[model samples]
Target: MLALPNYPGDGGGLIVDRAADAPRYEYASLNDCPQVHPDSPNEESTCQHALRDCPPEELGPLLRIWRRTVAGDVVLEPWDSKGLTCASDVAPGARPTLTMADLKAQFMRTPWAKPQVSSQPKGNITLVNLTTFYRVDWSTGGFAPGEVDQSVLRGIPVRIRPKLVGFTYVFGDGTTYGPTVSTGGVYPKGDITHVYRERGEFPTRVLTTFGADFSLDGTRWDPIPSTVTVPGPVTTITVREAQAVLVNH
Candidate 1:
């Protein structure tokens, strides 16, 4: 039996840093992806194959990803042009993941590769209709930010459980100051006034989760940042919320 689980010492060929631009750095396994080292008999490919083109039985357990090629790119196959299926592609045994990459790299096959990935929140607006105006004081309750994105979304599903997260309003003076504001969270009831000392593009964003989300094990934190290019002296202003990130490499 061609071992159902991963080939003993590897977690699918070092995983190839799925986030990396280049393919896996090495290949030397019996079930290696084919496209990688097809000609070199002993040269085994990475998981690119088992994940993309192999059968469910061949793919022991890591079948969750479904061998998606790429998010926004076209796959090609020059082997088709050669009429020999390209000597360097599809050998006896190869890494399914790397094979998938080669197929895409050839730029001769499918234009849009397949990807069975997870889902995230969509964008929409709604109004917050209060049950009792007297009981729900305007001071204690302000509209929480109502939005989400890949940079701050979780691996789990919100439909299964709610997430504890919210948003904060950024003023133009590079600080958050208090101003009587009204918002309906995910929905919008009417217009609310948030005072920014300057007039500019203050980035506005929100969180779909209320900080008590069941999707994540740890804190679902999102450093919603923005660059508000405020104009001189004007009570009513605009702002651009951007997460200023500094990478030290």
Candidate 2:
């Protein structure tokens, strides 16, 4: 008699008796043996051949049955190459791919420096005949053009390089200035200057826009499709009209 242990969820073991006049083989579940089709004329022969040559290594969730001979010594049957399959045969999903859009999203989330607005006349300024020279204090939170941010997404290494493209100055009082590439300098030579029409307290700020490039291998770099604009903290400037009175010396 040959005994095949049933797979999990298959109720009973299969028993084949060779001693009978016509050898009889009882199957527990037809679903467990996929090779045995009901429409096939030689289904029984195919099932028998499949069982005899089932590879043990390919035994997984569905094909975990073990064949053994129930005789004087109860010997284990050697497995061969046949119709069994394991989970490894199933196709896997596509690998993760990086794009320019993905890198731009990451660059926007990076902790970039917030610009600090500086004026030549400090806090208070005279409105008449005075031009407030505006500049960005790059001493502390300055732009690092060559700085690179690195990360790994689904085993793909990505490096992003941030570059300061332009600056926009908001001189409050309904006035706004350019997306110019100038960082603006101090006093006489400074290009970014604002003259207030009337005397009052005004709130001012600077907007910094950054463009970026990304790389997968560090050697080859590609530009990102978009740029990020960061706004700086507000700086209040008090503009007062200067009045002169003649006094005895």
Candidate 3:
């Protein structure tokens, strides 16, 4: 018996049950070609023999789905002779045209390392005055936007870049800051500074949200709906009550 996994998209591929008397389905590997001979590579396997006489249209979907299913685990080179030979029989433009979404999906398969975040204190100490304005050294955050031209399918160059969209700040008090744009405030300058009603130690951290855009065929970049959030280093701030006193020396 043969079946296809219900992939999220239109892509689907054949899952064959090798056991003659029983039926069980498992995710098929790219090298597990049922159509090819097991012992002799050239000899016709049961599946290859069956597909050889089948109509050309029926094979297109199977090939496409098979390509997408194991994309992250495998990299298919352009010089793959057998794959190219089978693909050539399909009509030109019969395969789905790759879009920005598809390109983004493909990019997501790669493992990208997260950038480091730096938090600095502005005042003399982490301590802040409850009655006065509070400030902390601000940074633009890491993973700043930059463009990269990547050679995609058929050697077409794709232009892609990342953008810092917003940030989620946790004050560590009972309250939380926003998906805000301000990069916090420096000493003597309070932009997104906060004042605590009481005094104690508060651990603060920020989660930065980054969005991406890509351009195919070197055209104008179009936004991709997906976004990645990276956590910033945690910073602890202490609030101290200040009092005024007069003395004569």
lDDT tens digits, residue span 171-220, model 1: 33465422223332221332322333333443333212232111112333
lDDT of 2 by residue, 59-105 (tens): 22232222322233433333222233332223111112333335556
lDDT of 1 at 219: 38
Candidate 2 local Cα displacement, residue 191, angstroms? 0.6
- The models' CA-based lDDT, in order, is 0.25, 0.58, 0.45
The segments of candidate 1 whose C-alpha lies over 4 angstroms from its true place after superposition are 1-160, 177-192, 207-249
Candidate 3 residue lDDT tens string, 138-218: 344423556453646434455556666777776768776768766665456645556667778777777767777666435
lDDT winner: 2
**Which sequence of candidate numbers ranks them by lDDT, best first?**
2, 3, 1
Clash count per candidate: 54, 0, 1
Total backbone collisions, model 3: 1
